[model samples]
Target: MPEFPHDDTTTNPFAAEPQDRLDANPRRAIVTGADSGIGRATAVALAAAGVDVALTWHSDETGAQETADEVRTHGARAVVARLDVTDIPACGDVVDGLIDELGGLDVFVNNAGAGLQTPFLDVALDEWNRVLDTDLTGPFVCLQRAARAMVAAGRGGRLIAVTSVHEHQPMVGASAYDAAKHGLGGLMKNLALELGHHGISAVSVAPGEIATPMTGQTDTDPRTEDRPGIPLGRPGDAREVAALIAFLASPEAAYISGASVVIDGGMLQMGPQAGAAVDTHDWRTL
Candidate 1:
C-alpha cells in the first residue's frame, strides 16, 4: 500500500480548552413554538434541568402562558414571546429580543415548524412559500441570530432543530414538509462544521409519529395508541422527545454534533418491510 500523506499543520478544529466550554452547564435556553407539544415539553424539561427558559408561541398566547407557568413550577425563570417563523427577517428580531430578555443564550431549539399534506402536483406557490419560509428560511435567520449571540457572549452553545423522520424518508403527501426538513437537516450539519471551533454544537432531532396538536392528537396519551409498523408499538409522547432534547442540551452531550437523532420508536426501520407488505395502491395517496 502506498503511504498516505497527512497535513501535520492542521489541528483538530473541534478541540476546545476547559475555559472555552463555559456554557457546559447551560444556564439559559430558548424554545420556539412553545405554546404546545414538543416545544412546551422541551421548555419544561429544560427548566427541570435547572435551565431558565424563554418560550415563544405564534397564535396561542394562553398556551404559552401555561407553559411558562409550568416552567416556573420547576423553579426556573420563564419568559414568553410571540414568534411567527414565516415572517422572515422580522422573526429574527424576535429571537434577539428573547435573548436580551433572558440575559444570555446557551441553548437554542428551532422547534417551530409547519407541515402540509398536499400532493406535489397540487402544491401551490403560496403554500410552498409558507412551508419553506416557516421550516427552512425562518429557522436560518433565527439560528443565525442565536449563533451570533453565543459568539458574542463567548460561551459554548447548542443549536438544535426539531426535524421529522421525513428529513430522512418521504411520506405520501408531504412534498413541501419533506423538502423543508431536508434543507433544515443539511443546515444544522453545516452549522456544526462551522461553529465547532467556537465550542458550539449543532444537531437535529427527527421524530416519527408523535402525539401532538400538529398530528391532530392533542392531549393524547401516546402509549394508549397502537402503531404496529413501529417497533415500539405506539406513538411517541411529546415529553419523551423533550427528554431527549434536554439531554442534548446538557454538558454530557457536548460531543454529539452534526447528528440527526431519531426518536421514532424504530418507525423508519420498517420502511422496506412496510412497502413489501402493502398489497394495495393506497400508499400512493395521502
Candidate 2:
C-alpha cells in the first residue's frame, strides 16, 4: 500500500499544546437526518468530543429536538432544523442558517438518506430518481456549500458521509440504494481530490447490517446462529458505526482522505458461498 502524505503545517498563534488536542473544542458541526438511528448516534458522538452540533431531521421535529437535548446534556451546544434533502436549494439554506446560528462550521456529516426495498425489475422510475436525489444529490449539494465556507475560512475542515456497505457491494431488492451509495462514494472521492489542497478532507463511512429501526429488527440479542457468514457472527450497533465516524472526524484522522471505510462486522469478507452452504438441519428450524 502506498503511504499518503500528511500535512502537519499549522501556524495558529493560539493553538493549544499538541498533547491537549482533545481538550480543544470545535465550534460547530452539522449532522443531517439526526432524528434517529446512525445519524442520532453520530451527532451524540461528535458532541461527546466537545463539538457543538447543528442537526437536521425531516417530519420528526420531536425526535430532532430530543437529539439536540442529548447533545446539550453532553456539554455541547445544539441546534435542530427541519430539512428535506430532496429540496436542493433548501440544502444550501440549511447550511447557511446553521453556520449563522452556531457561529461557524468545522465539520459536516451528510447522513440523510432514503431507501426503497423492491426488486429491481419492479421498481419505478420515480422511485429510482427519489433515492438518487436524496442519497447522492443531497450530499453533493451540502458538501459543496460546506466546502465553500471551509475554504473561505481557511480553517481546514472535515466532510463525511454515512453511506452503506452497498457502496462497494450490490444487493438484491435494493437497486436504487446500491446505485445511490455507489454514487455517494464516488462523490466523496472526487471532493477529496479537489478539497485536499484547501485543507478540507472528505471521507465516506459505509456500514452494514446495523441494528437500527430501518432494519426492522427488534432490540433483541443480535442473531449469530443464522448469520454464520459474518466473521463476527452478529449485526453492528449504530454507536459502533458512530465511533468510526467520530474517529474519521477527529484530528487523529487528518491524514486520511478520499477513503471509504467499511464497518460491516466482517460481513463483506464472507462471500455468498458461506450462506449458501448452510446445513439442512438449520433450514428445518426456519
Candidate 3:
C-alpha cells in the first residue's frame, strides 16, 4: 500500500492558562453504536469519567459486551443492548427500556450512523431512504425520547450527535451520506434551540477521517498512517474523538450548546484547494 504523509507537528491537548476542569461525578449516559470505534471509545471515556453507560450496538452485541466490560473496569455499571437505530418504531422502546433500566438518563450520545457512498445519480430511492432514515430520522427519534427523559429528570443533560465533516462540506461519491449528515447537523442545531431552556445542550461533533471500524481501520495505529490531506499528518484516533465527547458531557461544558465543532485536522479549510495543494496526479477526479 502507498504510504500517506502526515504533518510532522505536535501540539498540547490541554491549556495551562486556567486550572483543568475534570469531572467524574458518576452520571448516567447512553452511547449508541458502542460496539466499536468512536462509540466504544466514548463509552470507555464516559465510564472512566465516572459515568455509568448503556452500550447499544447495531449488529455487534459481542463488541458491545466487550465495551461494557471495559466500562465496568472503571467501576461504572455498564449494560449492553441490541439497538438498530434504523428501526424507527423500535427506538422508543429501546430508549424507554434502557432509561428505565439505568434508572434515569443524563447524557445521550447519538453515535450510531450508516454510510451510503453512491453518487447522486446512482442513488436509488431505497438507498436514499435507508441512509436518511438511519442517519437522520433514527437519531431524531432518539433525541426526542432522550430529551423527554432528560426534561422529566429535571437535571438538564448533554445531547451529542457524532456527525461527519461531510455535515459541513461535501464529497464526490458521498451524496447520500452527505445529505444525511447535513440533516443531522441541522437537527442538532434545532434541538439545541428547543432543548436549551430545559438545560439540555445539543451539539454536533464532526470528525474527519478517523481510525475506526467504520473506516475499515481497527486496532491500527493512526500515527503510522500517512494522511497528507489532514494537516495533522494522519487520520484522527477514535479515542481523540471520544475525549471530545467526554469533555462535552462534563459539567465544564455546561455553557456550550448549538455548536458544530469540526475535528478534521484542517481538512475542511483546504476543501476547494486540495487538488492544487496535494501536488500529485489527478487522484481527486472521480
**Model 3 agreement with the true structure over 1-286: per-residue lDDT tens digits:** 9986643324433211132222223389999999999999999999999999998988888899999999999999998888887798788689888999999988999999999767677889998898888899999999899999988976678899999999998887788889999999999999988877666789999999999988998899999999877778899999999999999999778767999988987889887767666676555445
TM-score of candidate 3 against the unseen true structure: 0.89
Candidate 2: C-alpha lDDT = 0.84
Worst 10 residues of 2 by lDDT: 15-24
Q: Give me the candidate number with maximum lDDT.
A: 1
Off by over 4 Å in 2: 1-25, 218-226, 275-286
Q: 84-132 in candidate 2: lDDT tens per residue?
A: 8889878788888888898878899999999988888889999999999
Task: Give the clashing pairs for model 1.
Answer: none
TM-score of each: 0.94, 0.86, 0.89
lDDT per residue for candidate 1 within 1-286, as digits (tens), equals 9996653434755556645483469999999999999999999999999999999999999999999999999999999999998887999999999999999999999999999999999999999999999999999999999999998987879999999999999998999999999999999999999998888899999999999999989999998998899999999999999999999999889889999999999999999998899999988987
Off by over 4 Å in 3: 1-26, 278-286
Greater-lDDT candidate between 2 and 3:
3
